[model samples]
Target: MTRCRLCGSEAMASVVDLGATPPCESFLAADRLDQPEPAYPLHLRVCTDCWLAQIPPLITPEETFKEYAYFSSFSTSWVEHARTFVADAVERAELGADAFVVEVASNDGYLLKHVVDRDIRCLGIEPSVNVGAAARDAGVPTLTEFLSPETGAAVRAEHGPANLVVANNVYAHIPDVIGFTQGLRALVADDGWVSIEVQHLLTLIEENQYDTIYHEHFQYYTVASAIRALASGGLTLVDVELLPTHGGSIRLWARPAETAGEPSQAVTDVLAREKAAGLQELSGYTEFSARVAKVRRDLLRFLIEAADRGETVVGYGAPGKGNTLLNHCGIRPDLLAYTVDRNPYKHGRYTPGTRIPILAPEQIAADKPDYVLVLPWNLRAELVEQLAFVHEWGGRLVFPIPELSVVEAASSKEVTA
Candidate 1:
């Protein structure tokens, strides 16, 4: 009965069914494990009319993100990515002190602080009261509220139009994506720009990045779906650039749809690539279902084989993507031993479905497990570097999705069976 959120089309078809996975961001306290944990289907559907791939609501925004566990400042590369984006956006926009900047879903003011350091006026719209307070402490003005059309208008009336509206990896988290995009249009000035970074759907299909599909993430978008979504909300996709982050992500630049501008060649090239990859049709979405199943099977097989050999395996990070992969494969602490995370919020907690014990990253050095399961596989490079010392103990790292393989710290180039 859930119509496509983008186009309101009734011709939505289920493409991939990850049956009843626990909420990805829901980490559990020790005393709460005895209590029952709830789960909802990660059944992915694509609109036949708009070609927008989405998941029907299994959980609400308040349930998923109000008091979130993950923090962007914990990741060094991600902070640097934000710093770089702030610099680039400021340069490209020719922004001065008079220009206002706003970031949606701004976690802990990681990006906006860079704006503030440059003496630019910055504001953050974060739904999580916890992180919003953190941003305020960090010297960035933040409003702890979910962005809606009405909220957008209020922000514009008070602060005036924003010259740069930045949303990084938060577009897919929105359930009412049209309303979210409309918020951008309602706040941005005619000459202003809105840049959104989301994981590209083409990469999700090609590289078996189904771990990125979680309950909080309502939709998966390619340039095709994103352009259509933006256009419908009164915005134009004037440019797009592919980045190596998050398996593969694309940064989309937009102006008011009525504003005069033509899409850059990068946008056209990425669209061409998506079309060549068959993203224009339903077959492309369907082909990914079998790949998801294969990843689940292969990862379980690798963990089982490692256990039989008496080799200890522990996980590296407790990211939301890791939770989906852990639940879908039904992996437990028995197979994975325990997972470690840099974020203190999750240190004493446990992963949602698989009930894997979460520990501090230092525990890995004390235990020196034979293998480390890099749960946030997208951050493989950064994690591998941080935990590189594990190699001194003859330990290797495991990349679970796309295929299960071992990477020896001694020989990072070689993939071990």
Candidate 2:
């Protein structure tokens, strides 16, 4: 029996099974077209004891993050988000020129750029060499290695305890959740704050965003699960904020258990809400597998119908979640002519498993496809607004998850009018 990764509980409940799929980033080279792709079972389960939702134990961090293709500087929205976070954190934490800041998985120095501008000492722990190189080039000193207790100790030895530790969209990617958070306890100063941003598990379930499932994202988190995980490492959650990024996300502010801060009402309210929603109960996870299967079927049916109707359907956002959704639904370039990505690195490459070419957003204007499918549905508003010119040509945007919907100019006017 597979034991829970976090709580060591054998009484785990099956949540959703996404079936076998290749790593979301394994976009093959043209020469390797004939090679067979490696696929693994993408089963997800939730621990009954600790309420942590995670994928089956299989891949290692070395296999996932090494040579990572994702660069945080690619997305304009993400860059802006990071800048805003750095600004807000500096003020809230009362960071000064002497203060030290550490960011885990700090790709391309997206947030650290802002921190360093204030002359504060900063260090970045990044696993991917290419992205880490980018961070170094951007004038941020980065250590290209995975964040573990050993690395944390090394960081503490080199830089002393950090006054601020920021981990954005990375807490879920780690497998050794306890050890990683313990490392945070080791690296952060006694009076320091550690802020982590993770996509909310409640939003995933309610919005039917099963596409976020992949080998890299080992865990899905709720406020209750987060509290449990942090408490295991002797940390106390002092604040929580609901963020609109990534469909929906939660930003948690924590510190050492010995130091006290006024816990926000948002934190308490969300915990109580999670309890009322049966997040800590076993039955909450029982029927999730069925819901996921239904989504797969519905999405496939919609895509097939669109293809039959001679729709020139394409995709937006070449993100990891987009890759999982495409691979899960078995979509190919035949169904989606190509995908547009803001990331210049991914622009010239093809999507993994699906083999769909990724292009720049300018290609949308050049081709004027009949339909633009929003893959990163979380950023649908930003994408739709940016690609509004497509609507001028009577082209519509399609979103498959939750349900397939068409956003035509007429419909847009109706909503606004």
The whole-model C-alpha lDDT of candidate 2 against the native structure comes to: 0.85
lDDT of all predictions = 0.89, 0.85
> Which digits, one per residue and each the tens of the lDDT, describe model 1 over residues 217-255?
999998999999898779999999899899999999999
Off by over 4 Å in 2: 409-417
Q: How do all models score by TM-score?
A: 0.98, 0.95
lDDT of 1 at 79: 95
Candidate 1 lDDT at 240 equals 90
Question: Considering every candidate listed, which one attains the maximal lDDT?
Answer: 1
Off by over 4 Å in 1: none
Give residue 153's error in model 2 in angstroms: 1.6
